[model samples]
Target: MSSINAQRLTVLAGPSGVGKGSVKALIQQHYPWVWLSVSATTRSPRPGETDGVDYHFVSHERFEEMIAAGEFLEWASFSGNLYGTPRGPVERQLEAGLPALLEIDLQGARQVRVSMPEAQLVFLAPPSWEELVRRLTGRGTEDAATIERRLSAAREELTAEPEFDHTIVNVSVEQAATELVELLGSPVKAAH
Candidate 1:
């Protein structure tokens, strides 16, 4: 098989509680060959999150510096925190012909569409709005105010579904991961 180009880069985005992380985890576990871009964030690492693995935790000043230096492919401020994808690593992956996947927010996805028009934007939607509410509240990690803010953002995000090239309803993590991999035009690898 030949190497794929930037056209193979897939951006997975959806509402706050749509199981985007779960689907991403499944892909990472089963498809080891897929290059998933780790985003840089100004938010402090949550419990069990590694610096370079889960996210590239950076200081707010450093993130600003990166933005000023034109290092990020896309960046957005969400819930008072800045998150962005570094451009260099993504470019390197595409240059090497590896199919790269970016799990980002709706704003970041829109930025990617403008910056890299050939990239495929995939929206991972929840089965229903009620289910999405349940998932967000069930987490128990955020306060009530934060939850309300997320729900508001989710409502707006859901309306933007038509903007994406593909929509995968995340009823099941495994199934969603499989659909995402297929959309990337990469052969699914057997689960290890």
Candidate 2:
């Protein structure tokens, strides 16, 4: 495989319950210096999620205002809530020569492909369709209706895996993180 530019901005995308968050967290644990952009969302905070950290929770009107002002690099509505990556923070990270990571949906990933053609897109895929269904249902957070919707969306997202520069099957968080870190060509602190 070709070496990746360490400073190149990367967008990591996958369907819900495909372990994107787990892989990202593992990467951060191994490479603390790497910067991951926190997205802004109009959705309410989940159980232990924090504002300004996990996500920048915003009101629907505020989100729309930001959209009008061209504040987001990409924005999309999912599961009845709006989610977007703030343009300023990501630009700052890239401008500072940092390896920036954006964990977003397929819609946002497509937007990044248009806005930043050089941005590397990585797709995290489940080992199998059955595994995906198991993971989604095992989450225990969503209802049957939501799970069904997510499964439908997952099927669509799976079709877009070929659109990414790389596809990593998330069988193990450590292995996936190592592969992702290698793809970024960045130094790691230590695996957690």
Residue 73 accuracy (lDDT) in model 2: 89
Query: lDDT tens string, model 1, 1-192?
Result: 233343467899999999998999989998887889999999999999999999999999999999999999999997699999999999898887778999998999999998898888899999999999999999999999999999999999999999998899998999999888877765434524
Give me the runs in candidate 1 sitting further than 4 Å from their true place.
1-7, 187-192
lDDT of 2: 0.89
In order of appearance, the predictions have TM-scores of 0.90, 0.91
Q: What do the candidate models score in CA lDDT, each in turn?
A: 0.90, 0.89
lDDT of 2 by residue, 1-192 (tens): 556886688899999899999998887777887789999999999999999989999999999999999998899997699999999998887787778989888999999998888899999999999999999999999899999999999999999998999999998988888888778765443523
Per-candidate count of clashing residue pairs (backbone under 3 Å): 0, 0
- Worst 10-residue lDDT window, candidate 2: 183-192
